[model samples]
Target chain A: MTPIDKNSNMPPESEAAAELLDTQLDAALQSYTVDAPSDLLAARILKMAKATPQQKQTFQDIETGNIRQENVLWREKRYGFGIAALLLISLTFAFGTLNFAPSDTESDTAEIWLEAAADLGMSDIYDWVEGQTNSMDDTR
Target chain B: MIYKADPDQDVLTGLMSGDERALKELMRRHLDRIHRTAMRILGDAALAEDVAQTVFLKTWEMAPNWVSGKARLLSWMLRVTTRQCLDILKKKAPIYTDDMPDISDTSDLADKKMIKDDSAKMVRKAIERLPNRQKIALTLSYYENVSQRDGAEIMDITVGAYEALLVRARKTLKNTLIRDAEISTERPKDDRKLAL
Candidate 1:
C-alpha cells in the first residue's frame, strides 16, 4: 500500500488505500458500543434540578446585573479611599497652620525686665567707668 | 408567516413555569443520547453520570431564558457535555490502558468472542489516546452522527477545523492500530509457547 501524503492530494492508488483504511477504522470504531444509562440517571438529574432555581430574569438582565454589581462595588471602594485621603489632607493642613512663635505677653515681660535693670543704675556703672578712665589718663 | 412550532417549546414553557413534568418530558427525549455521549468521551461510568446530571441541571436553569429558535436543545446539551468532559480530562489523566484485556494471546484456545472483545478494546484504547479535541470530534461525528455544521457549533469551531480534526483523529487511530498489529505479529515465539 502506498503511503498517504499528510499534506498533498492523494493519488488514485493512495485514495483507494485511504478509503479502505477509513472503512476499517469506522468498523472498528463502531465495534465499541455503550449500553444505555441506568434508570437512576434521569431521576438523579430531576432531583438535582428540582433543588435548583431556574432563571427568572431575561438573559440580558442577568448579564447586565452582574457587570453592574461589580462596577458598583468598585465605585464604592474608590469613594471610600477618596474620603480617607481628604480627611488626611485636612488634618495635615490644620496642624501646619498652628503658630509656634513666642506670645506678645512674653516679649513685653522681657522688655520690662530690661527697663528695670536700667532703672537700677545700669547707666551709673558706665559713668564710673568713664571717670576711672579720665583718672588713669591724668596719672600718665 | 408559517411558524413551525418547535416540539420542545411547550415543555420548555412548562419548565420555565416550574413544572416537574416538563422536566421529565425533556429527560425522556434526550437523556440517553446525553449520557451515551458523556460515557464515550469520559470512558468512566461514574464521571459520565456526573456530566449527564450537570448538563440536565444546567438545562433546567437556563429554561426560562431559552430562546425558542436560537439553538436546538440537544445541540446545547451536547455542547455542555463536551465542555464538561474536557474539564474532567484536564484535571485527571484518563487511564485508558488499565485493566485492558491482553490482546497478544493469539493461541488456538482463544475464542471468537474474546478476540472480538479484544479488538473493540484496542480500538477504544487508541481513541482514548487521541488529543481531547480529536477525541471529541471523532466521538461526535462517528458515534453521535452529528453533522459537521452541528459539530462545529458544538465545538465552537469552524466547519473546516472540525473536519480537519476528524481527519487527523482517524489518521492517528489508523496508524496506531497498524503499529499495534505489527508489534503483535513480531511477538517472540516463546511468549506464544508460554501462553499455550
Candidate 2:
C-alpha cells in the first residue's frame, strides 16, 4: 500500500503489531479474490445500456433507416439513368439502320459534287445557275 | 461537460445522456469489486455473475434519478449488490456449500500444497457455514476491502452494529474451524475429494 508513511516516525512496537495484523489478515484472505467479474462484463453491460429506456435513439438506429432510404434513392437514380441510356442507344441504332447517320454528309456532298461537275462542263452553266435562282425566287 | 476528475459523476452524466462508453467505463471501474462481493456472499460463480449484471442494469435504470453527494456511487453499488445477494439467499432454502470455489492452493511441493489447501478448505467451509448476516459482513469488510463505516452504510446499520457483526462472524468462524480440526484429528480422511 503506499510505503507505510516513512516520515510519520511511528514506534517500532506499533509497527510490529501492525505488521502482525497485516500478516494475519493476509493469511485469512489468501483464498478470497477480488477478481470474480467476467472479462466481458463491461461489454455486456454496455450492450444492455443500449436497451435502457433512457437511450432515445442510438446511431445504429438512425443510420439503418437512413441507409435504406439512401439505397432506394440510389436505386431509383440508377434505374432512371439506365433506361435513359438504353433509349438513347436504341434511338442511335434506329437512326443508323434508317441510313440517316450517313445520309447527311454523303448525300449532300454527292449532290454538291454532281452539280459542280456539271457546271465545270461550261455548257450554259451560268444560264442554268441564273435560271435556278429565278425559279427559286418565283417559287418563294 | 463532465469533468474528468470526478469519474462517478462523469459516468452518471453519461448514463443520463445515454452514453454507453460512460457505462462501460463505470462497469470497468466497479464491476470487479461488486461481483467479488456477490461471489463471496453467494459462493456461486453463475449466480454472482447474474447478480453483478442485474446490479448494473438496475444502476443504469436508476442513473437518471441518482442524486450525487447523498452517497458515494460505490457505496450505493455495495448496498444494491448486498441486497440482491441477500434476496437470492432468502429465496433459496439453504446456501449451497457446493458452490464454493476450491480456493485451495495447489503448489508443486506436496507438503506446502497439502497445508495450504487444508487451511483454505477449512476456512472456506467455516465461512460458508456462517449465518447470512455474519457471512455478508465478513465478505464485505474482509474480502471486499470495504471500510467498517462504509460497510455499515451498505448494510444499512450503525457502525457499532457492523463491528459487532464482524466480531460475531470471526468468533463463529474460529469455533467452526476448531471443531473441524478436532473432528479431523480423531477421524480418517482422503485427499481425493469429489467437488460435490
Candidate 3:
C-alpha cells in the first residue's frame, strides 16, 4: 500500500500539530523506564524456577497470586469440569444399560458401597474417603 | 564466569537447559527495555511491575518450546508485556486516573526542571486519554521504537492496521493537546531545549 500521506495535503496547522506530538511522545517514551521493582522481577522468577523442579512445577504451585497464571488455571478448571461431567454421563449410561448393577438411589448406593467395603476388609477405606483423622501417617 | 559464545543466540537454549547465568544475562540485557515499554504504555508504575513479572515468568515457562530464529526473544517478551497491559486496561474500564508521578525539582535549574516536568506530565496525560488500541500502537511504535511490522505483529494486526492506528493515535493526541492548550504552538524548539 502507498503510504497514507503521499497524495493528500494536510492543512499546515494539522501537520504542525502532528509534528509537535511526535516530538512530545518521543520525549515521553525516552524518559519513561520501568524500574519500579527495586530488583528486576526476572531475578525473583529465576529464583522460583531454581527452587521448583521442572516436572513438579504444577499449576497450583506456580499460579498462587499471579494474575496471568490464574487465568490459565481458570481455563484448566473449566476444561477439567467438562471432562468430569462427560465421564459421569458416560458412566451413568453404561451402568444403567449394561446391567452392571440394578438401579439404586443415593442411600441404596451408599449402603452397597459400605457392604462391599466390609466384604473386602476395606471398611477403613470408607473412613478414609470420609476424611478421617487417623494415624496413617505413622504407618507410612 | 564460564565462557559461552553468542549470548543472544543461545540464551533461550541455555535457559531451557537450566542455566542460571543465561537467565541472569538475559535479564541484565533486556529487562530495563521491556519494563520501560510496560511502564510507558500502562502509565502505572505498580501495574507495570506486575506485568514485567508475568512476562518473564511466561518466558521461563515457554523457553523450552521457543523455536529459535522464529522470533527475537525481546520482541516476544514485549509482545507478552503489551498483551498483559491491554488485559489490565480492559479490566479497569479505561479510567486512567491522573496520578502522575511526583516531579523532583532537584534535577536541573528550577525553571528548566519545572518546564520539563510539566511537559512530561502533559504528554503522559495526553497518552492516557487515548483509546486502548491507539495507546498500544503509540507505545509500541513511537515509544518503544519497535518497527511498525513488529508492532503490528505484537498487536496481532496487519501492518496496514498498525500504520492506521499510529496515524489515528497521532491525530487524536494532536487535537487533544491543542484543544487543551497543553502543547506549544510556538515554533518547534531545538533538541537540547526539549524537556524529555
Candidate 4:
C-alpha cells in the first residue's frame, strides 16, 4: 500500500471506488422510501386529538386533586359516624345506671319495707287485737 | 424545496386554530397512512390501529410546535412514526413475519412515483427486524429523506453512530430480502395497484 502524506489535498484513487459505493448506497436508501405513508397522516392525527379530551381531563381530576378531596370527605364522614355511635352508647349506659339500677339494689328495697312498718303504729295495733280477742271469747 | 402546505399541515393548523371541521378532515386524510405505517412496523392490523391512534394523538399535541419552515409535515410525521415504532421496540420483543402486505400499484402514475410492490413489503419486514436505533435511523433516512445529521438529531445519537446504524440496518435488510426471494418463488402479485 502506498502511504499518502496527511497534508495532501487530493485523496488516492480509492476515492473513486468510494464514490461508486456512495451511489449504490443512495439507490438502496431510495428504494426504502417507496412506502412512506405521507398521504394518510392527517386524518389519523386529528382523530387522536379528539379522542381523549374529556376523558383525559376526567382522569387527571381523579388521579390528582379531586381524588384527595374525595378521600378526605370520606374519612371525615366515617369518623363522624364512629364518634356519634360512641357517644350514644356512653349516654345510654349513664342514663340506665341512674334511672333503673337503684331500684334493683337490696338496701333500697329494705328501706321501703321499714317505712311501711312504721306507718302501722304499735299502740293502735295492740288495742285492735284485744277488742277482737274479747269478741271471739264471748261467741265461743 | 418549498414545503407544500399538505392537507396534514392544513388540518393541523386548522385543529390548532380550533376548527371542528378540520378535525374530521384530518382523520379522513391520514387514517390509511397511519394504518399502513403501523401495519408495517407491528405486522398486525389491530396493533397497527393502536399505534396509529397513539401517533395521531401525539401529533395533535405536537402540531403547535411544527412551523412550516423547519421541515415538511410529511417528514415530521415520518419522524413521529419512526419514533413511535422505536418506543414499541423498547417495550416488547421483536416481531417476525414470513410475508408482508402488497404495495399499491402505480402503473398509471408518473415515472418518478415511489416504488411499491412485494419488494417494498419485504423491505419493511427486514427494516422491522433491525435493532431499534438502526431501524429508526434507516426509516428516517429513507422514508423521510432526512439527512444523516438531521436523523441523528431526531434520534438523539451522534452522526457517526447513526451512520453505523444505517450500515448495519441495510446489511441486515439486504440479507433477509435475498433469503426470502430465494425461498418464495410463487409469491402473489397485488392486482389493485394503479386503481388506488
Best by TM-score: 1
lDDT of 2: 0.69
My TM-score estimates for the predictions, one after another, are 0.66, 0.56, 0.56, 0.44
Candidate 2 Cα deviation (angstroms), residue B12: 1.7
The true-versus-predicted C-alpha distance at residue A15 of model 3, in Å, is 5.1
Chain A TM-score for each of the predictions: 0.40, 0.28, 0.25, 0.28
Candidate 3, residues A52-92: lDDT per residue as tens digits?
A: 54332434545564335547878899899999999999999
Residue-wise lDDT of candidate 2 within A52-116, one digit each (tens)?
A: 67624345555666443556888889899999999999999998889854455567787798688
Residue-wise C-alpha lDDT for candidate 2, range B96-124, written one tens digit per residue:
33243333222322433344335665566
Q: What clash pairs does model 1 have?
A: none
Interface RMSD of each: 5.7, 9.6, 8.3, 11.3
B117-195 per-residue lDDT for model 3 (tens digits): 3556656666777778888888888767889988888878899989998887876765554433322322144334433
Model 4 residue B92 lDDT score = 75
DockQ of each: 0.35, 0.13, 0.12, 0.09
- Fraction of true contacts retained by every candidate, in order, equals 0.75, 0.37, 0.25, 0.20
Flag regions of model 1 displaced more than 4 Å: A1-13, A63-140, B1-7, B94-117, B188-196
Q: Local distance difference test, per candidate?
A: 0.76, 0.69, 0.66, 0.57
Those runs of model 4 whose alpha carbons end farther than 4 Å from true positions after fitting are A1-51, A54-140, B1-13, B24-36, B61-79, B94-121, B179-196
Docking class for candidate 1: acceptable
